[model samples]
Target: MMALFRNLFAAALFVGILAAFEPLNYKDCKSTFKINSVKADGCPQENGKCVFKQSTFKINSVRADGCPQENGKCVFKRGTNPTIKISFIPDRDLPKLKASVRSKISGGSTFTTFSLNNDNACEHGIECPLKAGQTYEYTQSVEIVNTYPVVDDVQVNWVLSDEDDSNKKEICIVFLAKITE
Candidate 1:
């Protein structure tokens, strides 16, 4: 009985570690950005495809500081700012870039757009005229205003598009988050 208990405990520990490092599920919107593969930390890939979800634009990783996971979703408190860190590699040279965020409440057909204080990527950490085949990291703190409805299972989409042509996207990522009081 002692050996059986020890084995079970070890297996459970291993499983928990795997779950904690699971990659963010995302979908790459079809656009001008071209890359061979996008890789995230601890995220596994098979046959040139991400195992978690079907995505062409893979980011290194996305971290939301001050947001805690509750019941498998990141909980964001109202009227607070959460810092987001993203690591990615641009496949093409981009002179100017703009960033935007939108959210879709669970069971809602339309997505509500959120305003950012500074939408310019250059104002953030990124230098203008981004080079191809080079990696870049962007950090920004987004405000979760009080006006937002407190809800669960909200689908948030973050996009980086070319300033000259909004249709040309440099990066597009989606993740699940929840808003709470």
Candidate 2:
């Protein structure tokens, strides 16, 4: 009876501690894009096809980790949901937009894609299909794995594309993140 009572008390204490420290949310993480730079024009090619015109969205900045890091590298803690903030200018409204993140480890790679809209069910409250000629900030949240495949550098590639026709890419951003234990 005494052992049972002690075990119950310990379990209660653990639950209380977990409740006190709320799980990391989207608002907690940061972006990693460069700041204060004029948006550049470029034609991105995917699968050997490139668009003739410049990208509709001009990337202004991407905030990740604590501060703005070069080459899109950011720092993040394990077991936390890291939010990436990207700012850009929409030269034109996109009827359909597709955003994806590709994470590459030593032996394998995985990609997760989402379409911005009300039904996307995004955890960070990101809505898609931006307005034309308007500047907007977008946030992407992802769960940082806590264990396995730990490396000094991880390549994170973010891509935005138009789905109206031919699925032309709008922007491609890459960042290296150091995941701390």
Highest TM-score against the true fold, candidate:
1
Give all candidate RMSDs, comma-separated.
10.2, 13.5
List model 1 lDDT by residue over 1-181, tens digit each. 9999999999999887435333333444553443223223333322232211222234555545545655555667898876665566676777888888888998999998888999997787777787876766665667899988899889777777779987665676666678998
Evaluated at residue 37, the lDDT of candidate 2 is 17
Please report, as a residue range, the 10-residue window in candidate 1 with the lowest summed lDDT.
46-55
Candidate 2 lDDT, 5-69, residue by residue in tens? 99999999988643332111111012222121121112111222111122335655544433223
User: Candidate 2: deviation at residue 118, Å?
Assistant: 9.8
- What is candidate 1's local distance difference test score? 0.64
> Alpha carbon lDDT of residue 144, candidate 2?
64
- Superposed by TM-score, candidate 2 places the C-alpha of residue 95 at a distance from the truth, in angstroms, of 1.9
Q: Give every collision pair in model 2.
A: 30-63, 30-64, 31-63, 31-64, 32-62, 32-63, 32-64, 33-62, 116-128
The clash number for model 2 is 9
